[model samples]
Target chain A: MALLEIKNLHVGVEDEDIKILNGVDLTLDTGDLHAIMGPNGSGKSTLAAVLAGREEYEVLDGEILYDGEDLLELEPEERAEAGVFLAFQYPVELPGVSMTNFLKEAVNSVREARGQDELGSADFLQYMRERADMMGLNADLTKRSVNEGFSGGEKKRNEIFQLAMLEPKLAILDETDSGLDIDALKNVADGVNKLRSEDRGFLIITHYQRILDYIVPDHVHVMLDGKIVRTGDKDLALELEEHGYDWVREEAAAAA
Target chain B: MSTTALDTSVRPEDRFISAFEVNHGEALNGTNASISKQRTDAIERFAELGIPTNNLEAWKYTDISSVIDRPYTLPLAPERPSLDTDDIAPFLIDDLDAHRVVLINGRVDEVLSDIGDLPDGVVVSSLAQAGSTHPDVVEEHYGKYADFEDEALTALNTAFVQDGAFVYVPSGTVVEKPIFFLHLTATEQDLLLQPRHLFVAEDGAIARIVEAQHSLSDAQTFTNTVSESFVGEKANLEHYLIQDQGPSASQVHTRAAQQKDDSVYTTISATFTGEVVRNNVTIEADGSFCESNFYGLVVGKDDMHVDNHTFMGHVQPDCSSNELYKHVLNDESTGVFNGKVFVSRGSQRIDAYQQNDTLVLTKDAEIYTKPELEIYADDVVCSHGATTGQIDEESLFYLRSRGLSKRRARILMLQAFAQEVIDEIQLDSLEEHVAERVRTRFSSYFA
Candidate 1:
């Protein structure tokens, strides 16, 4: 089994039966970095939302296997404890919870989930200081309320900083490149690149190929109309970038 | 008991009438001769105003009619219940050494109090002693800020006022240690206590007044308290009221303050548990360039209802006032926050900001919040906002997606909400104490 496997997964809004993901099949083995590129309403975010066990989205059919267990059965927090990380598209701003405190609780929660002792204040502070420095997040930003008043780039970079701290086995970056300049994009990619390992995998979802210029993906999947139409190597992104998603859309339409 | 001005038809069975008769017969004559006139007028005014009802605009959400019906004996001149230092040591903060004035059932407990080294010219005496010893000073500042004519609670408190903590910091003196004003209500019988405290900080004086409540009895203890704080020119005073009363205790606390030129007055009220609690906090900025801040946090559960009423009056130009009150209600608890910022007509360049936010955890919990602003000055800057909603789902999901359980996430969110108010506390140790309190309160909500 792969690190995260989604086999013919179908999803939609739980309350309103608006289909989002229709029979989407994807798999990411250990050490794989896959990018899902698509236009708007391509079910790219739906896949991320469903994998993270968001309550609003229902898994209509099929299965999500994480570490040989049914991923849909776990709660959002449980999936996170089981090393599934989702960098939100619009990072939430918690006005009172300091970034530092949030990170401390998150780290301790994961440790407790794994049957490990929680970190002491001083020890956790030292550990966090090191990771924060690695991600180039300043001390002042870490001390502020969680993502409150953060600039667009700072919110993205903070997500990467958290990714470094949690060190999850599988990370889903949902629209991480939506709002970022080239410099910020490079900084975020650099942070993610540093955390790449044989035991880790990433599913980067985006609409543009600009971010792919920084963090090269091992596989690129083109999605349209609630399904992945094609999967190819990294060059496939450039092919679509040069020729545009027009060809991919026409090809899927003809096949359907 | 010839109080013809009082309307007996409202709550015909109210025991407050008898309670007032007992206080008028025993406690009134013993107060300062100068204060006796104020007492007589306030008692008459109490009879006229009577017990506040839910109909009044100021008290639209709180009803005191049921509370007054209970049979309660005002402990104005009752026999002292024997208590020792061990009985109150737990109520005192374990962190500090300070001047302590312990008021037990509306009377001073001199033996249990520990008055550590106070600065020279600083008077940390009981209000009863101060009324007799410094009668002129006590009379000059005592009820000067309180509005007994309009406030029934103030009138009721003033009519039966006997003794409370009194601290006077003279000009050019700095009281470095926090004065611990412990109002301990403990009795073997049903007792309604009326405690009156007068705090005066002279020109260039600085002090912090800490009012902590300790309820040792579950026998329907009701405490009615009135505190008047006066800050002189260029003086600084930080007042904090922390209520950790018994589960069934009912409390009515009214605090009024007048700030002088270039003075600073900041008050924080943190309420934990009470059957019914009504707090009226008023800050009138009388001089230019004075800064006033009011921050409060209320945590109630299990039929508890806490009502906080604050009036920030900007009477002078170039002064700034800020108020933030947050409430976390659970388990059918109810809370009300009515804050008003009134800017006088000619008070130009006055800045006032008020915010009230309530977080209701359970479906049965409810909150009534009203933030009001009446500005007459053309050049004044005033803003009032109120938000009553459940915890943020996005923030909760964010916290939970970071590995925190739903309960843990909710608790963190609530703590962060309270930390905003707790951070405004100027004192470091007090901030920790409040944070600890907020944490403890949320644990039960999660449980």
Candidate 2:
């Protein structure tokens, strides 16, 4: 069985009958970096959101199996503890809650969920400084509010920094490169690359092909209308980059 | 302490009957006639309005029945006791010279205080002395700015008014040092202390005052206080009321400021004690181009209840007011915030904003908040909002994920919530003092 498997997944927002992720199927084995490239409104972010167990989205018909455990049965925080991390496209700004405190809570909660002893304050601060340095984040930013007044690039880097701190088994990058400049994009991709291990998987969701050049995925999947229609190697991403998403639409139509 | 036994012959209409009827016909030997008349008028008002019950809209959440259950006789003028200045030394902000006006058991204690330097044309003395020396100033502004007719606490304060602080800054004169009114209620027996403060800042003048209500003993006590301030045109006043009494004490405090045109008034209330404490502040902009800022921080633990009610009225145009209050409730504590802003007719171009935010740490802790905005003028901007919620779980998880324990994460979150209000305080020393007190109050939970 795959390390991460979604069989006939269906999901929608609560209080709405309209489905967002309909009959979606995907499988990812350990050591695989899969890029889900699609146009806007193609359910790229919704898949990331559903897999992270966002409270607003309801999983109506799917079963998500993460390393032989039912992923859908956990709460959002629980899903986070089970090594499922989603880098939000638009990070929420929490004023007054400092970045240091936010990351400390997240790391210790994940540790406790995994039945590990929590780290001491001095050790946590040292660890944060090292991880933040890897992502080119300022140590002072950790003393300020979480994402409050932070530039867009800073927020994205903070997310990657969190990914490095949490060390999840599966990391879902949801539009992680959207608001970043070239340098910020390089820093984020570098952080992700460093975190890549033999036992970890990655789902890189994005709309553009520019980020792929840096993060170089093992497989590329074209998502259209809430379903993955095409699966190919890295060359497919370059091909799609040369010819826009319209070519994928044409191929999907031809297959139909 | 049975509820039924506490309910007696005192009818709702005659709650203050016995207390008002027993009058020390002869004025206390040393008190002046002006103070006597002011006390008499306050007693009459108290008899007329009586103590407020839950039926009153603003007092709905706070039940003062337990306070009124026993008939509290006004304490006689007892011999003043000496205080160890070291106990209060920590609260004194360093480097700033302050005139310390000490009041013990409703009377001035001149022995334990230091009367600091005063600028030219500024008078800092006890209220009883003001009544004799500056009767015109005392009779004109004393109790006139406060709404004694509607506030029972104001009336009660007037009924028992004995000694407090009287500060008057002349026109264009600036007093560099703050005038500190230290109300120390010390007693092993039940005591009722009523203190009054009257501050008048002349046009173009500036003054800062700090009124601290505290109890050195842990016995049961009741402290009722009323402080009225009048700010003239172009004057600037910074006033702070800090309550640090023991947990067994109860207090009812009313502080009001009337501002003239082109004047600025700022009031900060820090409440960290008392078993049941209610603080009400009213600010009326009676002139144009007046600006007022009201800020309060209440930290409660165990079974304490802290209720704060504030009113800001813009009776003239070209005025602005901003109010922000924050409360941190832990254990089974309760908090109530009632803030109202009224822009009366003809008060065009008024700007008013009021916000109340509370953090409930435990399931049993509760907060009831009501913020209202009444604007009669069409060309005005007035908005009010109140919110009560637990700390954000995502924010909490985000903090815990950084490797800090859940307890420390919670303390940081609560401190952050409080810092939003604390950061707005302009006085650095007072802000640090309040922040330290908040940390100390929550230190047990974290430990």
Candidate 3:
């Protein structure tokens, strides 16, 4: 069975008729890395938000299957406990919560839900120190409030650090490379590459192809007008980068 | 023709005035001439200024008529209700290494207290005892800082200032552990308790004090308390006031502090549960290079009402004051914060900032926050801000997306909102206790 399968998903903002995702269908199996590349308003982030069960977006019509069960029926936290994770495009700043405490709660909550023993303080600290080093997250940042007074690049790196700590089975990265310098981008990609395993799936949503050069994806999908217009191997990302999204639009229009 | 005479009903203030006139001689039996004169003058002041109504600017958001209009047995000469340590075990913060001073119905109960051996030349005793044992100190500092010329509640408290905790640290002496004042109100009938405390830290002395009030019974209680603190030159004083009473208990607390040159004074007030709690704290920067900080947190639920009114008077040059008060109101609870900062003329290089933030959880919850800054010095830097908002949905979602349950996520958000103020608490044990109390309160409400 596929790790995640979204069938005929139609979503919109709650209490509004303006649709964001119109009959979008996608599937990802275990060990598969799928990259969704699109323009700004192509609903790539909306699809990611819908998959993560964001409350603002209403699932108008569709069924999301995770491991052969209805995924949309679960709350965001429940989905997270079921090994689904969403690295937000814009990480919210928690003014008084330290990163260590937040990560501890998240890790323990997931572990408790999975019937695993909670990590002790020493073990958790050790784990956090290692992951933070790998992601190049400053030690001082971990002790401060979560994402508070953090630079854009630091926020993105912190998200990646949280991803490593949570260790989800199917991770969704929503424009994680949006505000990153070249070194920071490489660091994030390297962190993602290290976490890639046969039993874990990834959905990388991006607008630029520069991130793809470091963390290669198995398949690249072009999204247009709230739907996937074309799907190909890694070369499709390069083709799109060279030809721009205009050709994808023309192709989608011609096909329609 | 029917006579249209004016409707003149006896107000709550008139009732209080009558009660004072009837009980004045008995209340001042053992007091000195100075204290007796102060008491008489204060009651006269109270008569001139009655119980404040909502019509007044300071009491605009909080209406004390409903609480004070009813008849209450005044604890003028309160009989100490015998309370064992077991009875007050719940009120004491665990692992708090401090000298414990117990007060029952406003009078210190030495039998049940545990004020351990203190350093030499440090006096920690009841106000009445200090009046006799250290007459000169009491006369010099008592009733000095807390001026009741305009405040009716403070005046009323002064009129009935029978007994409370009084600490005097001599020059260059430091009270190693905090002096914890545990105020317990255990009565079988409706009671009104007025407890007045005086704390004086001499030159270069340091002292940390903690005061927690609790009502042991279900009877309606109204507590009017006034405390005056004098921080001497280069002296440091940190005070914490915790009010965690029952549903039937209400309190009107006034704290005034005068800071001397190169001294630092910090006051943190946390109100968790109460019927109607109003706290008025004023700090006067009387000397140069003085620093004052005021941090307050209120987490109220279930019809609880907590109002925090603070004043920072920057009277000297090269002084700074920072004030922050946060409130979380749930269910039908309400909160108010009115902070005023006054910078006198020629008080150059003054840096004063005040901020009040509130989070209203339910639709019926409300908060009124105002920050008043009156700066007469053009060269000083002063800024004030007040904000009332709901819980941040984005932060909640972010927490839940990390796998926390909705209930836990909401509680965490509230805790984080409150921790910003709790983090300012310098004492480790007090901070832990407050953090635990806030977490429990938030969990129960969210649950």
Candidate 4:
């Protein structure tokens, strides 16, 4: 069975006529790394948001199955507990919530859901420090309020740091390379690469192919107007990066 | 005792006046001529001012008619109820090392309190004892800062002032540990209590005082408390008021502080549980270079109502005063914050800042905030702002997406919102205790 399966999924904003996802169909098997490349407003981030169970977006039609279970039936936190993680495009600042505290709660909650013992404070802190170091996240950031007063690069890096802390079965990275410098981008990609495992699946959604250089995907899918228009190997990203998204739009239009 | 609904026949003010007349002799009996005169004047002032009405600007938001209209046992000197340490163990902050002073129904319970060894020339005693022990200090500072003539509740509290905690630190004396005043109301009958406290920190002296109010009964209790604090030249004083009484209790608390040259006065008032609570805090920077900071946090749940009225008078030049108050109201609870920063003429180079922030958790919850600044000085920096809103949806989703349950996410968001004010608490034990109290109190609603 696939790790994640979305068939003919249509999503719209709650209490509005605007539709964000017309029909998004994708499948991710265990150990599969899929990169979703799309132009602005192509609904790449919206798909990620829907997968994470953001309440503002409603799945108007179709289904999302995670491990053969109805994914739409789960709450956001429940989806997280079920080994799904979404690296937010814009990390919200939680003033007065220490980064370590947040990570501890997230880590222990997932562990509890998995029928595992809670991590001891000492061990957890040590592991957090190691992961933070790997992501080049300042030790001080772990002590301060979560993402409060953090730089753009720091916020993106912190997302990867959290993804490392809460190791999930299915990881979704939504534009994590948006505001990162080359070095920070490489650092984030390295962190992601380290977390890649045989039993885990990754869905990297990005507008650029910069991060793909560090962590190559098994397959690259071109998303246009909320649908996967084309599928190819890692070379597809380099071609799209060189030829720009205009050709893909033309191809999708011609096919339609 | 069971309290009947509000009775509008006899005016509430007249009932208080009659109660004072009946207890005047007993209440004022051991007082010196000067103290007795002050009591008499205060009661007369109370009669003139009467129970504050909605027409009064200060009392506009808080309508205490229901609280005052109900018949309560207005005992000037109520008999202390039997209570052991275990009775108050639940109210006590864990691992706190401090000189404890316990007041039950406005009277000090020496048995439940432990004011261990203190440095020489430091007076930490009941007001009745302090009256005879440090008569000069009491005479000098008492009723001087809290203007009973203007505030009717202050006048009412002064008229029937009973036993309360009094602390006086001599010149250059530093009280190593904090002095904790635990005011408990454990009464069999509906009670009305008036407790008065006076704290004086002389020149170069430093002291920290924490006053907490808790109740042990289910009966309706109304507490009218007045506290006057004096911070002398180069002295430092930190005062904290923690109001977490029973659900049936209501309070009208008045705290006034006078700061002298180069002195620092910081006060934090946090209210967690009460039916109706009104806190009036006033600070007078009487000398140059004085620093005054007053912060407050109110976590109102259910149908509770909390109003905080604060005033900072920059009477001297080169003084700085900062005010910050935050409220988190859930359910049908309502919160009000009216903060005023006044820079008097000739008070040049004054820096006054005031901010009030509120988080209305439920759609039914309400917050009314007004930050007023009256600056007459040309060379001063005065900034005042007030913001009231619901929790940020983005922040909430961010926490929930990280594996926190919706309830837990809401708890974290509210805690984060209230932490700015809680972080101002200097005492580690008290800060932890208050934070846990807020968390536990918030968790129920979220759950």
| Per-prediction backbone clash count | 0, 21, 0, 0
Per-residue lDDT value at A60 in model 1: 84
The TM-score obtained by model 4 is 0.95
lDDT of 3 by residue, B20-130 (tens): 776777755556555677888898999899889999999999998788876677766657677798999999888899999999988999898899999999999899888
TM-score of each: 0.96, 0.80, 0.95, 0.95
Q: What's model 2's lDDT at B308? A: 91
Candidate 4 residue B27 C-alpha distance from true site, Å: 3.3
Clashing pairs in 4: none
Docking class of 2: incorrect
- The segments of candidate 4 whose C-alpha lies over 4 angstroms from its true place after superposition are B1-9, B22-26
Q: For each candidate, report what fraction of the true interface contacts it reproduces.
A: 0.94, 0.25, 0.84, 0.88
Model 1 in CAPRI terms: which quality?
high
Candidate number that wins on DockQ, 2 or 3: 3
- Model 3 — TM-score against the truth? 0.95
**How should the candidates be ordered by lDDT, best one leading?**
3, 4, 1, 2
* Error of model 3, residue A81, in angstroms: 1.1
Q: Which one wins by DockQ: 1 or 4?
A: 1
Model 1 over residues B1-447: C-alpha lDDT tens digits? 211222334463234555456556555566587566677687778778877788899989988667755656555564566888889878877676678888788778888888888888899999989988898788689889988989877887777677787889999899999998888787777767778889999999999988889788888877888999999999999999899887878888889999999999999999999888999999999999999999999987888989999999999999999899999888999999999889999999998888998988889999998888888999988888888889999889989999999999999999998889999887777788889878987887777
TM-score order of candidates, top first: 1, 3, 4, 2
DockQ of prediction 3: 0.82
CAPRI-wise, candidate 3 is high
- The B-chain TM-score of model 3 reads 0.96
